[model samples]
Target: MMNRRYVPDLPEQNALSEANFLRLEKLLGGLKNSHYDFQWFGRNNEPVQVHAEIIERFKFTSTVNLIKQNSALPKPMDRVQLTIRMYHDARMAEVVTWDSGRQLSGVYPYPNDRMYQIDEKAQANVFLGEWLAHLLRHGVAEREWTPS
Candidate 1:
């Protein structure tokens, strides 16, 4: 288990560095069934919380309200919700944008919304492991994640 805390200011150069992504990938790869809760400061200093689960696949649900930081407050009109899905087989990992509040257009199989694939060998920006690592490193967590 690794620390899941929000880092307000991280180095721009290492925003999503390969090393960081590798660390994240290793952490999640060892898990079976688990729930991870994270809290972090988003852009504009808004508090954001991400609830992630690891079952057959990895799912992340994030919520943020630009108008209010308190969770008890009424749902804000400017609330933003994002969902990400990562599915892995024996050969590669595929990441998909399950849902997003920012997109104003069509349904799930959108033309621009294509599944990103990452193979075993680390390539340029196509590494899903690295991407997940970056998210875990920057995304705030309520506590360290422990696999069940």
Candidate 2:
């Protein structure tokens, strides 16, 4: 169970997030069926296969973590995680990245950069697609993360 302090308690927001979660679940389910895989090149130029799988889904949020293929990395790197935070307002939903057991920045994908807002109109599928792509592209080049 997650700590109450970490879980948002807004009822309406939770509903919105739930809807987003459903959409995300559908999206990821499709990806899994298609056998879509993301590749991240390590500092040593070795390729790390990244697989997306849903770990948990709640009323107000959902979690999708990337599993490193062949157990090529350690705990956190072995699984890059993200959370979807639902909102009641027009902003809809927000996706937050987590690493090393800490939230890097809410709704901001890039690490070590100024935190910015995700597009308010973006749906869960699009948000996730872009985020995964960003991870593959910048995570290695800018974040100095090597596949373990």
The most accurate candidate by lDDT is: 2
- Runs in model 2 deviating more than 4 A are 1-27, 30-46, 67-93, 104-148
lDDT of model 1, residue 121: 16
lDDT of the candidates, in the order given: 0.39, 0.45
Clash pairs of candidate 1? Answer: 4-141, 38-141
In candidate 2, the residue pairs with backbone N, CA or C atoms under 3 Å apart (3 or more residues apart, or in different chains) clash, namely: none
Per-model TM-score, in order, reads 0.37, 0.33
For 71-134, candidate 1 gives per-residue lDDT tens digits of 5335663333333232232122323322333422222222244532221112322343443554
Q: What's the TM for model 1?
A: 0.37
Best by TM-score: 1
lDDT tens string, model 2, 1-148? Answer: 8733223235744455555555544434422332234566765676766555444545544345544442556654565445544333332444554332444332334232444334222333354556554554444321212222
